[model samples]
Target: QPTLRKLVGGSSAPQLPDDSVRQLLVEADATNELFKYCEGQGYSLFVAAQPCSYTTQVVAGMIYTVSMSTEPDPGTYYEIKIFKPLPHLEQKARVTEIRMAQR
Candidate 1:
């Protein structure tokens, strides 16, 4: 999987650090912080991303997922696991489910 830094818009692939502080790792940490804040406020966080084929078997299919959660504190990490469907899974089916959930 590409590091979260790249997923969040880093310019280049991650590389070894010159010092103890790994910038890419720090960036990822910041992203998680932001997500936590959004979730805490009851925001519906949506991620519509084109994940690379390295992790996702399908190269072209875009992934969409909604997440919301409560946290214990700054250190506690919670995730909304959007299940990656099989290649045979229909995108329309997922969309329908999401729409129905909102109704």
Candidate 2:
């Protein structure tokens, strides 16, 4: 199990940072989850995007918290939370929460 040594608190902590910060390790599954979430929420004009600056935690499965931007628009980012069950469970990823960042 991976333990968090220190947490970069707040939504702003995960924004695109310089070389010092780790880039979000985005997976296709997570991106797919975002697409599904946007569509389900009736976002008719949504753009396809790969969320950046993210973190994950392990519970019964994995929880992904990501920062996303659409259409290259600054301050138009959203903080999304997703839950992915362990592979052995063979469950689909689920979007748990969505918060618009105050960038």
Candidate 3:
């Protein structure tokens, strides 16, 4: 799995530090109920982060968007998105934006 920094930074954006990436992973790990559920159902979970504009609307500033996807199953998979505000911001909070679609 690519680090959150790498996923969000892409090829041109600024990269997040190692500590920041670790922090994001920790935060994402704390909310792994969906991952556990998927695993229980015999699916592998893949997670990565990306820059998201919709998160700005929810958080009022830059946000790290983490998405989890499962191995293909009948041309469908589960996806969950988590939003984390930028570290420089005073918010220092995390939010799970959405968890939907099954089967």
Which of the numbered candidates is closest to the native, going by highest lDDT?
Answer: 2
lDDT of 2 by residue, 59-95 (tens): 7877667777765677667667777788899766666
Instruction: Give the Cα lDDT of each candidate.
Output: 0.31, 0.60, 0.45
* Model 3 C-alpha lDDT per residue in residues 1-103, reported as the tens digit of each score: 8565433433324343355544654666624656566667775556532222221223444454433334444335334344566657745444454444554
- The weakest ten consecutive residues by lDDT in model 3 span 48-57
On TM-score, the leading prediction is 2
lDDT of 3 at 93: 45
List candidate 2 stretches off by more than 4 Å. 1-4, 7-46
Give candidate 1's error at residue 39 in angstroms: 0.7
lDDT of 1 by residue, 11-83 (tens): 2332332322222223234335445555676755465221111111122343322222233233322322222
Which sections of candidate 1 miss by over 4 Å?
Answer: 1-28, 48-103
TM-score of 1: 0.22
Residue pairs with backbone atoms closer than 3 Å in model 3 (clashes): none
TM-score-based ranking: 2, 3, 1
Worst 10 residues of 2 by lDDT: 19-28
TM-score of each: 0.22, 0.56, 0.36
